[model samples]
Target: MGKEHVIHTDGACRNNGRDNPQGAIGVHSERGSISERLPASMERHTNNMAEHAAINRGLKSAPYDNNPVVIKTDSELCQKTFGGGWAQQWERNGGRTAGGSKPANYDFVQDTMKEVNYRRSQGQDVRFEHVRGHAGDSGNQRAHDLAQQGLGQGAPQYKYGGRY
Candidate 1:
């Protein structure tokens, strides 16, 4: 086992067919500074998609060790889906709707959940923690800002390092 850590991720989709989309990931030591890790883009997408990508990227950035992780995010949907373990059901069904149809955001949700659970199985204590946005949470704020910036016509850094 090793020391635990904290990670915060955020994403944004500026507009569809009119604006670009972006995702950002921020990581912090349980005891110190935060790291901003993610790439922003100007591609068409939805906020949900960006948010999911942020969580996925954050999970991937975490080290695979027997250490606990506190994954922070501003997306309530993302938090609940991962924390409640319901994301598994969505994945097991191949991102399909219960009515034998297709869900709008089922694919990414299922894929991301699979990755999150996989990380957990690899000894990484990847726990989802919900955080309020624009309420003086430095890490969350930075991630949000980065996500917005990522919706530009350029590439942004996916990882950032600093104290929250």
Candidate 2:
């Protein structure tokens, strides 16, 4: 087992659920970093959606060959939904909540699960950890700043491995 990549991700939404709402995702790693505002088609209008998108983007940016990838995020919702058993139970229950209601952010959760499963299929050890937001951690701070800046930025760009 070699050095695993530690990716710190964050998301932000301006005026969520209001007119002209905007959301963005930020990802940071030792290889490089990405700070991109999500697209309209993604229809991400909430903070949690932005957070999930960041995770999805981070997972996609990382190569399947990179084993033991650790994703650190400030959103506990992400940790609970993906890393916790809630997502598994949801899948078992046909995407329904324990109360038999359609869960919120189903699309985001599904997309993230696909990424997680894909990494596992490639023999990668993927894990998620929750970090306190704005707690002075350098990686978390970078990601947080980028996510906030993305609220008014142009299309997002990825700089992973100096490729894209």
Candidate 3:
């Protein structure tokens, strides 16, 4: 088996749900890292949305190769929504929850599914693992710090450029 390529992603939303809420994504990989704030006019600036964007962008920008891609995140929702096969079931169920309710964050979930499937079809193994937030793990810490930058809390510690 080839070596794994690890991608640690995180999102932060300052004043979420309030007017002028801000969000951002932080991506850390062996190649490099990225810290990006959400667009100025985003309709929703929730933490979950920011998390979804980080994971999606990480997958989208990951290098296409034989190595497996492990996406480390603190959001269990993202892990369960995609990795738990709920997304697949939701698609088959016409995007309804088991209770017949419209699923939340449908767009982000759908977009993530597309990116994951496309990567799989390209021979990349993608996996999502939930990491505890604020843990001292180096990668997770770096990602969290970058996320803070996304929220305009501080400057990014690393230059942003790489395989993502």
Ranking by TM-score: 2, 3, 1
lDDT of 1 at 110: 62
Comparison by TM-score, 1 against 2, better one: 2
lDDT of every model, 2 decimals:
0.63, 0.81, 0.82
Candidate 2 overall lDDT versus native: 0.81
lDDT tens per residue, model 3, 36-149: 888766667888988888888787777888899999999999888887889999999999988998787787788788878877998889999989988787888898888888
After superposing all C-alphas onto the true structure, candidate 2 shows an RMSD in angstroms of 3.3
Q: For candidate 3, report its TM-score.
A: 0.88
Each prediction's RMSD over C-alphas, in Å, is 5.3, 3.3, 3.8
- What TM-score goes with each of the models? 0.72, 0.89, 0.88
Return the lDDT, model 3, position 93.
93
lDDT of 1 at 22: 37
**Once superposed on the true structure, which residue ranges of model 1 sit more than 4 Å away at CA?**
16-44, 92-94, 97-101, 157-164
Error of 2 at 52 (Å): 0.7
Which candidate tops TM-score? 2
Candidate 1 lDDT over 14-117, as tens digits, reads: 44435443343343334433333234432345667667767766666666677877789888888877886657655667755456566555656666666666
